[model samples]
Target: MTSANPHRPIRGGAAPAAHATLPARGGVGLKPEHFRHILDTRPDIGFFEVHAENYMVAGGPFHHYLERIRADTPLSIHGVGLSIGGEGPLDEAHLDRLAALLARYRPESFSEHLAWSSHGGAFLNDLLPAPYHAGTLARVCAHIDRVQERLGRRMLLENPATYVEFEASTMAETDFISEVVGRTGCGLLLDVNNAYVACVNHGRDARAYLRALPLTAVGEIHLAGHAHDVDAAGAPLLIDSHGAPVAEAVWDLYAYAITLAGPQPTLIERDNDLPAFPVLAAEARQAEIVMARQAALEAA
Candidate 1:
């Protein structure tokens, strides 16, 4: 496990250009609806991202199209079911499958959420929240170490969009994540949309949350839409449902984060309400506009 200084100066010259590394300037999640457009048009996107679990099937059009897409543009593999925060040990079979995908695709970046998705051998298919206590932190660090060791690469851990806070939490979310980076040497996939959701749900200030974050550890950024739901008590609960275009508030938060992270890879994730490729591509273009404006400011 290793940790780097968050405030250290970037060694490269002016952040390596927008598309040199990841989120690529702006990218859209590789949805089945947009395969042809992506392949034929080859739109000016930074990269394409895919859920590693969705492509776990043996053979299908999905993998075939993905292969073609990968040949043209950079790609990122995001895992949603690794259950890295589970109380038990790392799942060897799952890791082997993930490693196989990495071997075949060789994506530019690979990431997973810091939350767990399983309990007592049952897969919940959702990123469940974990307590930010010492015991859970140690367990999560060990799991991350094993994951990085098995995959033979460092992974970016995304902050979970949590709806509930456990009484056992003894540290702030940012502190817990910073500690994880310290113990495991993994980078962060700072999802601005999640920060907005968490802030609204927990009645905290969004900008302050972002300000407290260790932006230097952030390797990528995720921008997605969320749904507002109310519980039995009629309290506001924001769900990380990537079913629509990013809201304006999220865009504002993204601007702030870009200032801190200095134009890292960013993705627009739309898993539901699957629209045409042009629609999603347009949203990606909006992200490009934002990035370009930010870069211009930096150059000035």
Candidate 2:
């Protein structure tokens, strides 16, 4: 896909320097269940990421422990309810809350989904998809600009795993993502599992989709678990369900993705069916092995 504005210089809002503090090593989604274990063991995790909305409360055990954890390790704030892709004007109140959270913690990285999750003041509690068209494109870019301008920091936008496609879409998913990056100067949270899931569901080539994306804008990578079910037509469907272990297929795709994008701040996300800290750390080790191979390949 051609860039939206080739002549326009890409902005540093999503630049690597914005995340220089976050190592290219692996991290896990910070969960309440593992809070004590993490603090006790102080595992060799590169960083810890959390859902920004979860910590929006002013004072609580979550805040208490996060303070201690932040003192020891780098943190990345991932926002799930920004509704950046929503058609309505960006929610000012929500933005203010997020800005306050960032100011309080000063995480190494902050990210939100490209999907919307709210309509009219009512929250859907799900990351809803948006059609990829010129009109929708303009709306998303403007929302991202406002997010950066209001928060006073560059944020990464993640590609959502979609089960449906819009007839209104005039561009491929990769092209749509690249257009967003080119227009907003935002970095991408390249979710390899999501790309594989969307490709399998849409009968598209996953590797081709990965190869086509603007890898230079990717400051981070995500590996997650998925479920295999059938669509309405009974065709095989891969759901982006982060309930189980990372699928081997997604891991293979991740290995290839990192080879192209080089080492990134890889994250292993398992929001459901939470596993033991050791199990998650073992998966992270697998990611480290892949990076090790990349180091060897580049050296050769």
RMSD of each: 3.4, 3.1
- At residue 39, what lDDT does model 2 achieve? 86
The best candidate by TM-score is 2
Which lDDT tens digits does candidate 2 get at residues 1-300? 224322233444434444455788988888989989988998998888999999999798999889988897888999999899999998899999999999899999999998998998899999899999998899998888888878876688898899999999998888988988887777889999999999999999999999989898887889999999999999989988899899989999998998898888889999989999989888888888899898899999
> Number of clashing residue pairs in every model?
4, 1
| TM-score per model over all chains | 0.92, 0.94
Q: Candidate 1's residue-wise lDDT over 1-300, tens digit each? A: 334322222433344231235644778899888888888888877788999998999999999999999987889999998999899877789999999999998888889998899888889998999889999998988888888778877788998899999999999998898888867767789999999999988889998888887677787899999998996689888889998789899999898888777887888899989888778777777877887888899999
- lDDT of predicted model 1: 0.84
Q: Global CA lDDT of candidate 2, please?
A: 0.87
Regions more than 4 Å wrong, model 1: 1-20
For each candidate in the order shown, give its overall lDDT on alpha carbons.
0.84, 0.87
